[model samples]
Target: MRADVGRVAEALVEALPQPYGRWSIAVFDDPTPNAFALPGGKIGVHAGMLAVVRTPDQLAAVIAHEIGHVLADHSNERLTQELAVQGGLMLVDLFADEPGIRRLAVVASSRDIDV
Candidate 1:
């Protein structure tokens, strides 16, 4: 991650409300044209996104969109909904023992569902 990107992330986090201290951001070196924010305020931006985003505002738009989902508690809702629909309440506790569950949740939630 570039120092400037890190600074931008820090600034964005500072501008957020309430659970500000829980947030973190990272820039991945991959060239995949993607970015995502995980639950608990983890954000990841891909190198390809940086290359194509064109301006700080555009980049901010991408980051802000991800942050919006986090702020909206979409993942938690999705998890709960998925559990109910799948009748996976018995397996819900598995998330506590599975790091992969959290990672998958973040990735799934970060996807642009509207697209």
Candidate 2:
């Protein structure tokens, strides 16, 4: 974690409306301009984004935006939706005796997205 990012994470967590857990910031070496946050306070910022972001405030904006997604419970909603869909399919398989349905369920359950 970069010192600057560590500071930003601290400030952001402090500013957050509710209590948050330990957060980690990771700066990737890749050149693509991108950033995302995952559950449990894991934040990843692409190295390329640093070139265009220009200031700590801009970077903070990006971090805060990602954190907003976590705060909104988008990830949990998606997981619930996926599970419902997969469960339906698995139920159908129970009647049809299709082994492939279990494989599909595994794949679906493993799917995830960064916020």
Candidate 3:
């Protein structure tokens, strides 16, 4: 499994070069059919995933998908978006006493509109 992951990773790196750090693959003994990739080229695969995947190519596809997420910096993007939303909510709460802003917030929340 390690060799297979290494080969697929090497091919992917050659195909889509990035300034990512060293790639490391870890297999967990969990029964859940899951896998994930973190920033900086860290990948993890659950043992049950092998049972669910029938072919090496399928495994490669899974690994590639996870790698794509890391390459795109999805985690950081999600974090930034969440922080921005939280900050906006905090600002709205802080200014809830102001008449205009409070009315806007009430209308936006009641109608599920983005404000």
Candidate 4:
């Protein structure tokens, strides 16, 4: 299993332009059909995913997709967005005691709005 993953990963890495991170792939014992790639080139594949993918090419495609996410920095971008949201919520909480602000927050919350 490791050999097959390595072969496909090598091919994909070779096709990319120079200066990608140092990659490492690990097979997890989990039953969920999932795989993920982290920043700095850590790839994880669950045993269930290996069972579901019928061929080497399919596995390569999955791995390549995860690698694309890492290369694009989607995780960091998502974290930044979440943090901004949390900060906004904190500001709302801090100002919740003021009459006008409290009224607005009450209305917003009644309407299922976080702000």
Each candidate's TM vs. the true structure? 0.64, 0.65, 0.65, 0.71
lDDT tens per residue, model 4, 54-112? 89989998998888877887668657765665676678778665667645544554423
lDDT score, candidate 4:
0.77
Q: Tens digit of lDDT per residue, candidate 1, span 1-115?
A: 2556777776677787665447777889998988876788888888888888877777777888888878887777767766653554345555577766656655664444423
lDDT string for model 3 (1-115, tens) is: 5457667767776777555777777888898998887778888888888778887789888888888878888767756766665677678777676667756644554422111
Candidates 3 and 4 compared: the better one by lDDT is 4
By TM-score, the better pick of 1 and 4 is 4
Weakest 10 consecutive residues of candidate 4 by summed lDDT: 106-115
The true-versus-predicted C-alpha distance at residue 4 of model 2, in Å, is 2.2
Give the CA lDDT, 0 to 100, for residue 95 in model 3: 65
Whole-model Cα lDDT per candidate?
0.72, 0.77, 0.73, 0.77
Record all residue pairs in model 3 with backbone atoms less than 3 Å apart, i.e. clashing. Answer: none
Best model number under TM-score: 4
Q: Which pairs clash inside model 1?
A: none
Report the number of clashing residue pairs per model: 0, 0, 0, 0
List, residue by residue over 10-111, the lDDT tens digit for candidate 2.
Answer: 799899878877777889998998887777778888888877787889878888887876777767877787778777886777787877877776676555
